[model samples]
Target: MTTAYCFDLDGTLTRQELLPLIASSVGLEDEISVLTEATISGVLPFDKSFKLRVRLLRDAKLDWIHAALSEQVEFDRHILDFIASRPEQCFVVTGNLDIWVKPVLDRLGIQSFTSTARLDDGRLDGIAHILHKGDAVSSLRDRFERIIAVGDGMNDVPMFEAADWRIAFGGTHSPNRLLVKLSDFVINDGNALCRLLNML
Candidate 1:
């Protein structure tokens, strides 16, 4: 059936949010948290907030940022195993910068759709592109007959709208209220989420 699975990176696949972890490398975790909360609450738009946060942390050493993310982020084991079993059908669709989350993506060993980072001399210069999750889903239409999306936040609304099926996952926390409203299924446990994916 050429089914594709699209997963949100932060909080959905990984137990910790990547941006705050990256920000911590520069002692800006508190600042990043404010923007993250505002975005999640719909007070700040994802694009604007993402850019501001990126600007705030752009000067942090790339090696240190990568090391922190690799050390601090934890993935949901059940879901990680599920993707590992069928890596070809899975994609990480995230608004996070490609360079910042490289470690996580490498661990999953799956295709990914992420915001692009501008680089100058091996340093993070700025954001080159901000990915809209809906576009990521649309880009997959030609390749997959059916797409199933999993996420847990307000930022994921566009992705949910574009997918054939939406699952609001809360393995780390409660699924966002609006996201739950848009989802075909709401699951709070990692193992149960894998079971539902198998059934689908």
Candidate 2:
């Protein structure tokens, strides 16, 4: 059976979250982080929090945002290398907007499923749709025999539910408590994460 690995982008695959980095680029990090924290803690819905954060960052220059991400974001080398060995078998599943995260995803050279952004005159408009991560995993069912998911947020609950193997990673910090309860394994080190991915 063919197995596919789905990874969450923020805090799981990367050492930091993307939205805050983008917000920091435009000097709105503190404002955006309030909404980001609420969403992750389940105080706000993912779609609503995402839209609000996007609106707050609407004026941010794409070039500046890209530069900030490139400068501050660091991928877990061990996980990055593991996926690099078989890019086709991996997918990045994130609630981040496609436009905002394109550069990072391109750098990884892997397939991804993310929220779509509505654009107007080459500028940010609004969200076209918010991705339900579980649906992304379900869509992969036809192609892969077993699917493994790794993430660290409440938003990742759906993905964990949809996947055959679930891992809650704490490389950046402690994973969401609920996600830990749902996970088959909890890995915190990059090398250990890579080994778990290999075993799955």
Candidate 3:
């Protein structure tokens, strides 16, 4: 049976969240983080919080955002290497804007699904569409017999529900309590995570 692994970008694959990094580029990290925390903890809906965060960083220089992400975003090398070995079976599923995260994703060189950005005269205008995590997983049902999802936030709940096996990762910070509750396994180290992926 074919198996697909769906991974959340921030905190799951990478050591930190991308929005806060983007916000830091514009000197609004603290403010954006408040909204980010609310969204992660299930206090705010993912779509609403994502739009609000994007709006707050609208004026940030695109070049600076790219440079910052290129410099700051750190992927779990083991997980990335595993994906590298079987690129077709691994997918990055994130709520981050496509434009904002392109640089990092490009470096990973793997397939992904992200929220697309609306552009206005060559600048970011707003989110054209928000990706619901569950929808991303459901779309892959026809291709894979088993789906394994790894994530750390409330937004990943839907992904967990859809997956045949779920892992709540806390390699960076503690995973959302709710996500952990639904997880088939909870792991916090990159090496351990890769091992679990192999076994799954």
Candidate 4:
């Protein structure tokens, strides 16, 4: 049977959140943190908050944003190794903009579903599309027989709902309470999470 593993990029695969790192490039980490917290806490919708954060960080140079993300964003080694072994079956599903997360995606060497960016003159103009994580899961149905999703945030609810199996991962921190409730499995260690994936 063909199984697809879908991992949320921030805090699941990566040790730190990408947007805050991108915000740091333009000295807007504090501002971004507010929106991020609100979004994760379910106070702000992911799409609206993501757009606001993107607009706030839009003025930062592309090179600086890339450098900040590349330097500060660290991946969970155990999870990274698992994906590297089966890159074809692993996918990073994130609400992050395409341009901002290219470095991370390139490193994983796997297919990704991310929000698209609108660029003008080699600069970030705005968001062209905001990805609905559930839609991403549905889109994979034609290809994979079974879909397993791993994530740690409120934003992952739709994805969890659409997936065949859900794992609430807290390798970096505790998975959101609601997300944990929806998951078939709750794993807090990267090694344990990968082991569960192998078992499934």
Per-model TM against the reference: 0.97, 0.97, 0.98, 0.98
* Candidate 4 Cα outliers beyond 4 Å, as residue runs: none
lDDT values of the candidates? 0.92, 0.92, 0.93, 0.92
Query: Model 3 over residues 30-149: C-alpha lDDT tens digits?
Result: 999999999889899998888889889998989999999999999888988899999999999999989999998898888999999999998999889999899999999999999999
Question: What lDDT score is found at residue 160 in candidate 4?
Answer: 99
Candidate 1 clashing pairs, residues 3+ apart or interchain: none
Q: Write the per-residue lDDT of candidate 1 for residues 28-118, one digit (tens) a residue.
A: 9899999988887678889999999998998998899889988888888999899989999999999999998998899889999999999
lDDT string, candidate 4, 1-200, tens digits: 99999999999999988888898888898999999988877789899999899899887898898888888889888998999899999999999999889998988889999999999998889999999999999999999999999999999999999999999998887888899899999999999999999999
Runs in model 3 lying further than 4 Å from the true structure: none
**Which 10 residues in a row give candidate 3 its minimum summed lDDT?**
46-55
